[model samples]
Target: MRKILTPLLTILHRNTCFSVRLAAMALIATLPGATLAQGLFSPAITVNGDAITGYELEQRALLLRVLNAPGNTPELARKALIEDKLKLQAAKAAGIELTPEELKAGMDEFAGRANMSTDALLQALAQENISRQTLRDFVKVNLLWRNYVTARFGARARPTDAEVDRAMGRGGASGGIQVLLSEVIIPITPQTAAQVEALADRIAQVKGYDAFSAAATQYSASNSRADGGRLGWMPLTRLPAPLQSVILGLKKGEVTAPLALPNAVALFQMRGIRETGGSDPSYAKIDYASYLIPGGRSPEALATAQRIIDSTDTCDDLYGIAKDQPPQVLERNERAPRDIPRDVALELSKLDTDETSTALTRNNGQTLVLLMLCGRTAQSIAEASRDQIGNALIEQRLQSFSASQIEQLRADAQILER
Candidate 1:
């Protein structure tokens, strides 16, 4: 009887211990914030068996919004995360991993963009419920991917001298003169003409390319505002007849007197001049059109522009998009490169016939100018700097290769959305 009772007590104690452990787990599941944490940290999507949690998506969207990135925040965040996963996987496969020190340095560099120290940035993010880990993760992936691409593809990404020369607009048999010019175009209406002229006069008085660049950033209406108004070497023949004498007359670091335009006043700062060998036809005239959209850089406006880009293969297709709008909305004209406005010419330089640029803005950022390249009539030109040409070619090739590699990675990835 004593043996039976002892065995029974031991069995009861073991059963009680198991019951207590199960009860505690059930209590934890029902507790405040516990279930919420589980849901937030749970996998939202799986890329090649690796999970991207809901919390990560929320953090990324918040980060993009803070950084003023364009487009839909959530959608963009999701897309970015998917790409990040792919990049990270590739980096791992290449045996390229970011060290802890390297990650901290990357975090520091990112904080510097906001003029803050790493600790300060972390504190600021914490106040907004963004974890420091989120920033670290973002920087880590970017740094690793960039390093990986350079290491893996840098050797094959170099551009030849001939490619660079052509990119620099020196690909023809005839040699020509090219001028390196910085420009500022201030849009003016009748009511604001006096103010525009006064501003232009002040800018002209300010000496040096740096001063001119500051003025361009503060006041220029062109899309090249972000570039400090620097227009890389353009053939002298590409400029308008009226502006040719003005640009050539100015000494280096000197600004042009205000030149009046139909809707704006223009100023040019001569940076330098050079002659290149091998004459490619300098464009004597360009035929193009401009269509205006109401919101300058808004997502909706950009989406519409993208739709137009996708639907239209040539400049003629733009006429349909402009149908039922104002007549001036689709203005077509043939003008020399210089007469086309420096910003417009810069955009045109990047495009082939029938291509379009959504780079320029007007009416002080309230309007988007869709510039369509209709055609270019080329004239004979001189040879350009082979070194400069080579550098430009190499840069372009690297960019193209980087993009192609990323697309290929995406194609090969096995992504599963949870």
Candidate 2:
């Protein structure tokens, strides 16, 4: 299954654990000679009085590998199995039990996430030497824990009107985070990789806007380098989703750790951040194009880019410049913000409609990228309602309770690794 990369590369991969089944299968199904590792049936771990067999540990580790879960697979498998055992124990103590219909529904639901029937899923797993019981047990514990949480915390987790309004950005007041940032992007070719990495790390530690701005002016490969890499105040929602957390975590004047991007490294200094009046708008789609040119960041490539910039007024104009080139050299796409590649989204955030940037490269720095923003389709918030927002808040609160409950169980239970 681990060799299944090529055929399944086009299938959508959901990052969350529950939704990754199809993607995981896609990853594992293509392996030509892969075989499961077997182990003795002695206990590998114990939670309270329940034993986790060595065979079960191996099964889970294989599953985690298929899912491409990060870190040591065996360790992660052990931790997860321990948590599941605790969760089931807590569910049992709370008198949670599923009917046959409910268990079937849970199995169907889990299989549905991968667009497979329960039988189909079981057959697929069987082909990989994973038992049907393993799938049933995994689904059973999750269902039990969910029922336990809902029964115990549902009533206490309801949100008030004010809380709902605040969450949905309709609090009848201007609210949402906005940030001012200074950036430094250093191109990293194999020849300059070590130097660029060291430079980026050093820049990350530079204190104050002036110092950071100086570094940007001296070394940044971005257009904003001329303005000391200063960006105007931007709504947090307008940034790439991954970058939002990094920005939120910074204090004014603190820099983010050097973020790796295609052919470059980026560092940002937080100039200022504040809660601004107004809802932070979401976009339904972003339309953009990228034209690849030969000779990355070389004098000729830069001159060509500048010439193209002067001649082109919109994304459509790029078609003329790339008229004779291979189709793959030029790309135009309209994607939901969440679906855009992180590096592309980051660059798009810094542009207005029809604006172009040459800040990115491709083909391992052998080609320069000419990127243009076509336009953004703003997502309508007309359907957002009090009830929808309130229910979401309640779910969040319940999840918090669920996490704490598990922690309490783990603390009170005797868990030992054999």
The candidate that wins on lDDT is: 2
- Candidate 2 per-residue lDDT, tens place, 255-281, comes to 999999878999998989988777776
Candidate 2: worst 10 consecutive residues by lDDT? 12-21
> Could you say which candidate leads in TM-score?
2
lDDT of 1 at 159: 68
TM-score for each of the candidates:
0.43, 0.50
Off-target runs (Cα >4 Å) in candidate 1 are 1-31, 170-395
**Candidate 1's residue-wise lDDT over 171-223, tens digit each?**
44465677898888787666777888899899989987888999999888655
Cα lDDT computed for each candidate against the true fold: 0.70, 0.78
**Candidate 2 wrong stretches, greater than 4 Å:** 1-175, 381-418
